[model samples]
Target: MKLWKRAAAAIKDQKSLLAVGFSRRASYRNTDLEAAIIKATSHDDSSVDYSNAQRVYKWIKASPLNLKTLVHALSSRVNHTRSWIVALKSLMLLHGVISCKVPSVVGEIRRLPFDLSDFSDGHSSLSRTWGFNIFVRAYFAFLNSYSSFTADQISRTRANLRSDKVDSVKQQLDRIQKLQSLLDLILQIRPIADNMKRALILEAMDCIVLESINIYGRICSGIIKILPAAGKTDAARSLKIVNKATSQGEDLAMYFEFCKGFGVSNARDTPQFVTIPMAEVEAMEKMVKSVEKDEQKQEEEVVEKAIVLLEKPRLQTIITDKWQTFEDDEYCFSEKAIQEYHQDPLPLVVSNQPVCYTMPDLITF
Candidate 1:
């Protein structure tokens, strides 16, 4: 038979049987016809049946498959009954069918019993589904482990500091250091995965850093307040060591840089630097003052030299005056007065004839 003829006949048969509400007579006849088709198709031993089975599996996997459609397909041998459909059903059950706790048509399917051996074949779609599910489970398990470890560390630190006897500065510093180390460990793991899980791990690490910084700041403040009054040099030294160690840690260094860049300096009454016992601060101030004095002296010397230079005499150019004689027919002043005039108020009138001069020749020429 032609392929379209077979498909048309199958559709017609299915429609007629479905119209009858799958009555006992029609169901038995359809089941026998389905069995005959299965036997005949199997004789050829082609992969068409397997491919059809995969198509049915994909459809069922993509959405909630109804029992009626599954039963119809299984009875018609359009898809497999024992291998494909039954195995897919079992895999769905293993994926937490019940606690998915869906309260709808899907809930009925979840309530069905499933056998493990139905999907025992490794090549089955059932096994592939289960493998993906297992991966998800393992990923979550790792997340839980990281979260629990961080929470436990925080709880222990809180417990340690709760007792008055245990509030020693050394112990507090140790706790902060351990917390910093744990944060580093978390950050190291963030780059290992490429998915939502990695994103979640990074987010968790950020929270840990924030929480740890808050705790460390509080402890350091407490230590600072008590250490100065206790007058214990060893306690102060330990605090310094803690500060240095924290600065060396990568995350702590980043935090410090961030705070230094953006945090405002609070106005506290400047604590007496005298009590700090390190003379470096005082020496630095003294050195700055000395440098200022030297600079002022140099400026004063420059000004004094500039003033002396300003007081010195500046040279002036002198020009000798020459007298010229003119016979003034129309005269306003006497010739004696004109000759005795050391400076001329105006030029004397001279003859109007033009005069020219030529260069002198050399004696050899």
Candidate 2:
């Protein structure tokens, strides 16, 4: 049975290689992208192919339009494969692509082109590979959510940056909360049962660790922005976020510990926990109160000014109905004076002949 399986796999590999060799068309620049994708997601590869995955990411960076081809190729490979290994590998490759953070790529991948929500392994029975099937589904869910989350973050960042006003504390807090939710999702991507020690799963975990670090950084950045600018009303929410951030920090520390136990190398470099002083929160609240008091004082000053204006005597003018006359010279020139002053050059002509008038007699009834 093993021999037959090996022979079948070898034949499949040969056919895949031939297809890749012939796949160099207008859609791709060269055979490298196609070959890289194939090798990176190959079932025969005992471990994740980081090189090919990175290569694919570089191609995406060089030309984001290549995403269409990448999506099609990945979809075809993953959807047709019955092996959990290939599915996970393809997903990991896609995960690496998203890590590039290109605007176009992030925008385009806001929703995945393919579906894996109901993926089931065909190579093995339901009883044997159910764990893997679940793992793939969980991983897919995370990726889907992660893509949308990233796109939203990018859009909000661009909008805030373009605006004249500082980004609102509410918006910043919202972003942090989203990151927290994503972190929860990240925590749920653990390998199940016998697949716990698999190198490929560990690779995926490593990628997850990197993603966690990125999210943590963004959260820290958001907190920093919120702390100084937050008002009393916002300070309360900001405090909750701070507390949540601290809790999330601890959660991350524990998560790293989990990853370290699970053998993800990147977790070894997990940063220290985030801690915010209550003094800062108090300062923000006090500042908002002082600002409000100043505004009230200004309003009182304005009212006082208005009252003073009302108390002072107002100047009044009386209107008369009497008529007055002015000399013609002081006003308009008379019509006769105008005509005499500006005479016409042409002489007036008068008819010397006189005509007799005739009238009809009225009849009396």
Q: Considering every candidate listed, which one attains the maximal lDDT?
A: 2
lDDT of 2 by residue, 1-365 (tens): 75776577657756776887876477444466777888788775357677888888888898877887788778887777888888888888888788887988887788676788898988767887788888888888889888888888777677878885565678777878888788777777776676457787788888888888878878777777678877666766777777777787888888888888778889886776455667886676676677678889999999999998889677999788975667966445677766775685457668888866877667754
Candidate 2 versus the native: TM-score? 0.70
Ten consecutive residues with minimal summed lDDT in candidate 1?
Answer: 266-275
The lDDT per prediction is 0.39, 0.78
Worst 10 residues of 2 by lDDT: 23-32
User: TM-score for each prediction?
Assistant: 0.24, 0.70
lDDT score, candidate 2: 0.78
Q: Which pairs of residues have clashing backbones in candidate 1? A: none
Residues 233-313 of candidate 1 have per-residue lDDT tens digits of: 334344454454345344554544443333212111112111222343334345556666877999999999999988968
